[model samples]
Target: MKPFSVAYTSACHFGVIAAVHLPDDPAPVPDGVLGQLPEVERDHARTLGGYRQVSFVGGRLALHRAIRGLGRRAGPVLPGEGGQPQLPEGVAASISHKRTLAVALAARDTHGSVGVDLEDLGPARMGIADRVLVASERALVDQLPAQRQWTAVLLRFSLKEAIYKALYPYVNRYVGFEEAEVTPLRDCQADVALHLKEGEGPFLVEARYQWMDGHVMSTVRIRSGTPAPE
Candidate 1:
């Protein structure tokens, strides 16, 4: 059997998302999997242990699958500045993993920088509502049904994380949770407004999220040369 099974693969507005479900056993990342990675990545994986290694391997596998779906041969996705995946030229991608699942979102560079994040929908995250939501966002959540408030908060939080990942390669700076506001729209879409300082003014970014196996998968694509409305 394959070391991991494909949980899902779907086309998105930005590109494609591939999710891989890893085996429960974290050690010994299955035969031949390491060979699939570039020498650099294999060497790097050697430095990791336990679940970290599993996550790294699973992420790379998912990424390769995603790039292939985009009609490109996958290359070494080395870690660039800040450990972001340095995808092959003309490709934009992001990776996120939680426990046994790794998810990747990839697109042609023409789609601009892209990011994906996977967050577990668990009660433990319920208490983070105040920490992640801005005042206006909190007000929005307050209007939700009591049972849905935490889900709303988590959705916004996940989208903001994706927004950060999508924008960081350009801004190359820390973007706090409060720096971006996410207004969730219907049909699994959301709008992002960046509150960067004067010079960091504009970025044309779009955000979306979907529920998968009790986790929220969020993605954002920032189109180059397009500016966000004032």
Candidate 2:
């Protein structure tokens, strides 16, 4: 089968953002290549279901290639305290999997942090929107056609997830849903503002998303010292 896709972006001046999509069944990793992952990763793979294992390894494989493409070597990407992948020094990456689709995004140290998330598009469940959306966002959704509200909710949720993944390492804590908001822009893009509960941050993350083979993919790139958008 043809490989899914790989693309680069200049959204972050400090480093290029590269994304990879694994569409078909993930290619098997040889022992040598699999060995490149840290023991935590290998051990974690064993704990996942068969399909989850494929995605887990596929994500690591994609990250290896992404980092290598930057002309640098990233040693075994390990799992941190929360099972988030820990990139080698001077690098940051995020991975998301949806069914057969696995996407990974990577950036160099200068870029600060990178995060990407993929979610299958579907209608929002009752009460979900209220739980995830802030006041202004909910008002915007209310103005849209009833049928369209679910999509808006899903988009906001996905953006928040991407933001959370990007900031968790720095925050060292879980960011709440009510604490962040996403405002849509044209061409499948959005701006996210996060109000860190612990007063550590009021950071901003710029996001762009696309529909790929039935999934919504959102990517976030945060440059070091990037201030909140006015």
Candidate 3:
């Protein structure tokens, strides 16, 4: 079967996810991306690099693949709380992978930052939304058409994750899901507005989302200097 492929491009940002149904047993490293990992990362390379598993290896590859399109030599991929990847010195990045897909997002900002996440818009067996989505978000998403509700919830989470990743470096504090609110979809993007009642006050963040081949991918860009293309 021909594997599924999804591509997204914005300004200097590019992301791609190739389908992988193979077992996550450390498949042989691909010809191009193996840059001999440090002893720490090598121990779990097989498990991490293989599909279906989420580990440092998967994170590194997602980070690398996302940045590859920009012709960058981003040093090593750094890790943060919750296993999120730290962008290179000046780049803003966020990554997410599920089952057989991996997605990365990056942006160089003058003021604000950017984040991107992709998720499988399938069943809710994980009950992940309970921990992440606020009451309001669930209320709205649950009302979406049966065929679209799954995508709506998936995009909401994906967009929020991207926003959190983009804001982490500057704010240096955890942003709750409730503080972030996603407006109805406009064009291919969604307007993200936030009201941080606990740590900070209200602010605005803009995000975009798209559904492709049963997967929902979203990107949030919050820049201070100037905005980039969607």
Candidate 4:
């Protein structure tokens, strides 16, 4: 069997599973796989173009595979609080797509919650970094060499997204980029502290990233308390 790009790390109690799919030569996804998506997903699919459709399906497929690998049966993957993929009870997961590439991560509820994101490496978007980075984050970016700063900025962006996804069920509200501070550590790993506007937080999530096939893929796993009531 051909291999999928997957990374695994122990987070919380159980394991965090991150899987990546590069559809440069994707195999066909079964129609039955599409059938497993909830109505919201079906409607969302209708709005996707050809490339997105393929990546969406591929993401769903990768998600299913991840779930099954966790020893659970594959079932409907729905959108829940904050539009994140709602996993089966006792499961927490996240999915992200960039152009033709999609990535997903999952862990049993016992493992806490997980969020994954993928971003293609490229020249800096003119105003994006400033808009997304908080004062300290921007200052840190300035400390890096000119050429490598954008990649760091993009990595922070991806980690912020991963944090939002990981905590939305707990926070149950929109989290902006400025709410969290991301510090990239060594070994392609990073840490985030969520400074939510209200509620009991300053939640912490850890992230791991990889650079592959010209893309930066990041995954955040939170395994402290259980997910917030939904």
Tens-digit per-residue lDDT, 1-230, candidate 2: 33334433333332334444444554454455447566767676666655566677767766666676677777667678986887778777888877555667777757568778888885357478878899999999899998888878888888888888888878878788898878988778887777767887545467887766667777787654557568
Stretches of model 2 off by over 4 angstroms after superposition: 2-40, 123-127, 202-204, 223-230
TM-scores for every predicted model: 0.92, 0.80, 0.71, 0.79
Q: For residues 19-66, what per-residue lDDT tens digits would candidate 3 score against the true structure?
A: 222224445555333444444444445454344333344555555555
- Which pairs of residues have clashing backbones in candidate 2? none
Q: Go through the candidates in order and give each one's C-alpha lDDT.
A: 0.84, 0.71, 0.60, 0.70
Best by lDDT: 1
Per-candidate total of colliding backbone pairs: 0, 0, 4, 0
Residue 104 lDDT, candidate 1, scale 0-100: 95
Model 4: colliding residue pairs: none
Residue by residue across 4-102, what tens digits does model 4's lDDT show? 333332332224444544456444444555565656665666566666666776676567666766777546676665677767788877888775556
Tens-place lDDT per residue, model 1, 1-230, is 25566777889888988988877676877557788787788888888888888989889889988998999977678777777887788988999998778999999988689999999888656778777888999998999898998789889989988988888788887788888889999989898888876457457888888997789989999865656458
lDDT preference between candidates 2 and 4, better one: 2
Q: Model 4 residue 103 lDDT?
A: 61
User: Where is model 4 more than 4 Å wrong at Cα?
Assistant: 1-49, 224-230
